[model samples]
Target: MPTPTPSPDELLVFTGSYTPDTGGNGAGLAAVRFAPKTGSLTDEPRVSPVPVSGASFLAAHPSLDVIYSTNESDTGAVSAVVRQDEEVLSPLGAPVSSGGANPCHLTVHPDGHWLLTANYGSDTMPGSVAVHRLDTDGRICELTDVAVHEGTGPVAGRQESSHAHQVLVTPDGRFVLATDLGADAVFTYRLDTGTGRLQRIAVNRTRPGSGPRHLAFAPDGAYAWSADELSSTLTCHRYDPDTGTLAEVSRVPATTVPDVANQPGGIVASPCGRFVWVTNRGADTVAAFRVTGTSLQPIGEVPSGGIWPRGLALVAGHLLVANQHSGTLAVLRVLPTGALSRPAPAAHVPSVVCTLAL
Candidate 1:
């Protein structure tokens, strides 16, 4: 008998979009089937599951059976959807309140016990981080706790109040870190697994106006990098897992274009921990860097192939960028040397803000 060849992995890509709130054209959650080998996506995505407003960020369950998204509306909420098949998703239940206003980012606990959200408050509202208990079926049950952050950064218009942008879990699953764009701080918390509660451990302050937005940790949990939205910089930090503390290592510009208005978006560390990539919205580029033990050496940058690149995902050696303003997803090849090739023509999506691949 002849030997059989294995089929290429079919990448199931999930995207969240900004709806009426952000002047977005999206109707709801969208799904696309991507072929990794060809770097191509289905001509037209099947946008379904739910017609939610402000489904801006998404997080997948560890079991890959459920998906959660932040409903970035005046009354913040998190919605859950069950994965019915390769190309189908259905709402699991009614969205539950995030315990704050304008929830922007979320992540599932590695242990599959909780879902965490960062609520980016408006000018009159205060920012907060909320934890929700997850039932055995991966559906969100109730808001277990909400950790309200206090403080403001130096930027008057943008930092007049706390704006928690993202919530991320440590690789070890013992702690949770939330980045506050308006506060210019990364607040750390100890996760009580048994209770699904968040206990404030430490607050790591960044440069006065850095406006830390999103973070990515090294594979081994030794180091971490934060993408500062207001400052348009990437700050490296030495991560102490046991103590849940982050010490600044270095801060560098995320874009090579000098004096250009830049807003850094997503930050992702390569699986092997050799490289870190950050998206520059104003410059419409993806900046690549070589990671060397808490130090970042700029490698180069490649065009995002669209406008306002807000999200990035590394899947099967390819870098996928979600350009929110242009409403397209750009696929770029990631070379072994940590450089990126020119991105493929944009794939259509309406106000795409985040990407998740499985």
Candidate 2:
């Protein structure tokens, strides 16, 4: 008997891009449909109805028809949009200040009560994480709390000040973790859901000059992994959900050519929690690894099918890469052995930095 082919899933993907004012030619948030069977994307993307600037990152509400994005500007801001249908998005309200400079990443609380932003400060500014309240309509209503971090790594130019690159809530939804590239640390906090305040809990330090960028937790929430942007390395840790403590287990290169100028962009663990993947920007590749009880064994690496892959998402058994410099989205089929095939170009969206599938 032969295996039956699975029917394709119709996926609505939203892409975030750098705007003209940010040194790129992006019109703003763009939408495209993806066909899983053919590994193809809609020929043209539908631009957002309203103008948005520096929408470098986006996050979808866990259970609502709404999307949130970081403005990624000197005066940071975050915006919300309501999904009118499968194809259209309507602005929910005016953009709200993110309470810091150059806000880069944002995420919605698992309970859908709060929105969080990680601001990557410039030379003159300090990095901070801000929280906002989400209204019944899924719109951002007001600022709730802001936690500012102070520290620096050993790196000379890149670690001059604190730069929080990403904020992630634990799978149990009890704690929030922020990655600071400039500080070489992952700061842990307990979120006060009622007040939106963050209580500092723990600080997990990585190797000096590692420049921890982003992290993904295991499906069971027992482990966590981080992609180091500066040293081009990956670090694994045992995560204690109850205490919000991350204990380091191991560190390994994100790419085979470690001496090269490879910068890891995004890191994700497989849905089954058996595999982990990281995107290498300078090398333009995706590295795969086998996860074994909080330890990592390098699997292999494959071409990203474009230049400067910055963000990646796993959708419907496929891996999608947002190639920032090449202005293209690439799709790779995830094999049964937990490896990714060479990607095929899907769509062209200029200066794309983030991909969110809903």
Candidate 1, 134-161: lDDT as tens digits: 9998888988899999989898799999
Question: Which parts of model 1 have CA positions greater than 4 angstroms off?
Answer: 1-9, 46-49
Q: lDDT tens digits, residues 93-160, model 2?
A: 99999999999999999888899999999889878999999987789978988899888988899999
* All candidates: TM-score: 0.95, 0.95
Each candidate's number of clashing pairs is 0, 0
- Once fitted onto the true fold, the runs of candidate 2 whose alpha carbons sit more than 4 angstroms away are 1-8, 46-50
